[model samples]
Target: MAKFDLKGLLNDRSVPDRQQDQKIVYRNPKDLIPSEENFYNTEKLERLKQSIKLLGILQPLLIENRDGKDYVIAGHCRRKCCIDLLNEGNDKFSRVPCVYKTSSELEEDAGQEDDIVRQIMIIQANCYRDKSDWEKMTETLKMENLVKELREKAPMEGKTRDILKDLIGTSSGQLGRYHAISTNLCEQLMSEFEEDRIKISVAYEISKLNKEYQKQACELYEEAGILTLDDIKGLYRQQEAEKGIPGQMTIETATGQNRPPEDDTEIPAETQIERFYESTNKNMKNYIIQEDKNMTIFMLSNLYGTARVRNGHLNYQGTTAGITFNPGRVFEHELSWQSLAKILIGKYGHKKPIKMVSVDIPEKPKKKDNEVSGPAKCITGKSKSGICGAAAYCDTEYNCCAQCPDDCNSRCGWLEERCQPAAEIPDEKQPDFVEEIADHPGEAAALPVMKNNDQRKEWLRNYKLWGLWYEDKNIGVKYYKYDFENGACLIAEEYILPGTEWMPEHETAFLHLVGGPEPECKGGIPKWTYHARYYKFPNSETELVEFLKELQK
Candidate 1:
């Protein structure tokens, strides 16, 4: 409980005799110590600097003589302005006008209790300037700390609250709020509230929640990018909803065995299933498909049993020995060959069919636009050539599909036959393709991509999602880890400004998406060749799909 001895410093009465006239002395501005209770305004400081440049110090600074140095009790800002001007090589500001206080006069003014008098003087000096609520709260906490220390030495009854009210010029109720904020709120939330990122009213409401709930709400706030009063209200509602209590009721009515009211807003089981499938498909399209060749290979291999190049014609292996047929004719009974032909034409172009005896066709020449030549290389460490092949197409690279007696294509033949090439589906016709995938029981669907502003807003609102901030250089790139719950813990790149204020326009891209699915198999993790890095998210796959779907909207 060690504290600075304000009483001893202010109460010392012995002093050498001096002239009675008040004298102004020129002193180095840097020697003046600013008052800790004083708040600095950048704008005002700039204005003050300009004024001093145009006109010399009109009034001398009031400084207390302490330890052979000047402690500025008043005109701190003006002294600061002079100091800055001096630093810029302005000779006119090299020495500032200051009036020093005599120890004998200060002691005489203190009366009996010097510590209380000293506190009153400090408060009175700052009272003329308007202060923000945050600033007031900060000052109040300092006074309370001083009072607590003094009370330990000299026990006082109800004088603490009254003294605080008088010093801060606020009512007991307002002082109570300041005390609660200082005592009850966590350090991080307090900082945010002080920075204007959080409203005082909203902060007070949050202070009411338990520590765990408060932490969770903070997490939600960071994830949502911005947290408003309405957002806080929504969170409270969600918490109540989770507790199954939207309203209060009489004990008899609550205990009575009556059918619960039907909820018209509840999503139907079928609709939820459909949405899940749609979301899953969208995610696949946005993140899973790495190459046009891979998708084409997937579609073709799924449709026809191991496609092979035989004597320059595209054909499918037949069940009988040495027998093969054109893929168009083999699935002609089930599919529209004309649409399939058009997809092939769009993807491979209308080139003359190549002639090859073995199924292993020579690798096609590299694509012109620097696109990936084929399916993603298998990283499972199981492939013979270390390149992904037909075997790598199963649900898991480590194990073959359990449902397939022979191969996945044979078992899931119906899915392949019904599926259309991704390229063939026009932008407007893509929804139908997703519906078709949803109709199937076990097919992996691609997730959607975020396309427009409205969709982005809706997605952000629905999932409370925040975009990742990124900066890339040739040598390396940086990723910012935003912690919504405890903003003080944010790990960001140097370029990002400090604070939790959400700026959607400043968002570069989403990375390390939390609440997304893990790779189905080891080494199945997605890879990007672009000159950028991403963090891995460890959230559930179901939540990831829903999150991505909203992002896609």
Candidate 2:
């Protein structure tokens, strides 16, 4: 007999084979353990179950053998559908095709040292499926944690991030953002982010804030129903400003002072005011002048009932009676009358006697009676023929003096004066010709002037209109200016303090006195914005100071 060659016979095609290496095997659904990382879609699972019922499972579930139990490495959704089919009394779904791998085989398939490879497999399995952003973020976080754990067990020599970038299929920058969300964000915020209640970018930004601030921000979110990026940035800025940080934006007070944080006990009011004035310049003169005027009006209405300037005069219509002032010089003298009125009211109440006292007036220079000063002889000593002379007063000639005293239309001051109508006597009943005074009684004899460039800049630096500041060491008056209508409107804002709750009532009286439209208020607090029609720009520092004095009344 010929010796049997078993190896050659097995390889021979003539021999019938009874057994071969099996690539797939049917296993009971109850024996497989579901993966925690898998996300289920109900609609997709139902469609999958229908497909399985019709054609049977075409793909085998990938499972890992760990300690005598089968753990699903992939095909989790398909396994779930098979289990559902069996539960619905389909005995054909009781067992499903599975490709099994032992622990040693799995470790060999993906390098034992490369945990990121395993995580990558898990994430890549779901890549073809439609997953929500929340679900993707959760997977990204898991991958991030795996990378961190791998980094600790065996250092990757800076290749850990590169591995993460590969595993997450994102750039290095985006990988860092995912890592931040995983490491920094609290569990509650993470849940919110995952549920799509909070935006990922917003959650990342919120994570940058301190834990206490984050808690506060969450509370604010609950109250506001939503938190915008700008709102979050504003809160951050406010927090930074409160800490006296150098680069943070601060609230500018009306008196050109910064509203320091509540905890700044070491900072002196004078120092803060001085520093504020030093930083700002007269570039904000227009804003300061307008705010001062608004503050004046706000204060006067409170002290002297309904007070305002009408027809170039200070008009006061109070609860008891009405009084008027000619305000001889228009703006400053009106403030003087306000100061005087306040004095009278404080000293003698509303029944104070109103009397007119005779005051000496400055005499104008007397023109020589023999001076030949008519249009024929121009003020420049030029003859009318040489100085825009016309036959008679006419508006048609651009160079002609229409109101010339003489027949010749020469440009002469005397000619212009002679052609004007005489002035009317001011009403004696109303206060007139009061002396120019300081903003406060006995504060100073003369108002500071800004004649030169340096002086004007200094004035602007020290100027404050509205907002809270120390007024002789008090924090009652708080004001703010908001730009409206592309700078067409400057809104003066005022807030009532704890000790000075009556300030809002006074502000309401001022608003009513100005008489434009009622302010829109959300809470009980009232806000007032002076209309440009009633509030005109002041020309000089003296005018602004006097305006503030009138308001201080």
lDDT of model 1 at residue 374? 25
Clashes of 1: 19
Cα lDDT of model 1 by residue, 233-338, tens digit: 6666556545656464434446864435523233322232223224334423332233244453344435443333223222234221221333344232122323
Q: Return the lDDT, model 1, position 54.
A: 95
- Model 2 regions lying over 4 Å from their true place: 1-22, 36-59, 90-92, 101-106, 109-120, 148-158, 220-231, 251-553
Give per-model TM-scores: 0.36, 0.37
Provide the lDDT at 440 for model 1. Answer: 28
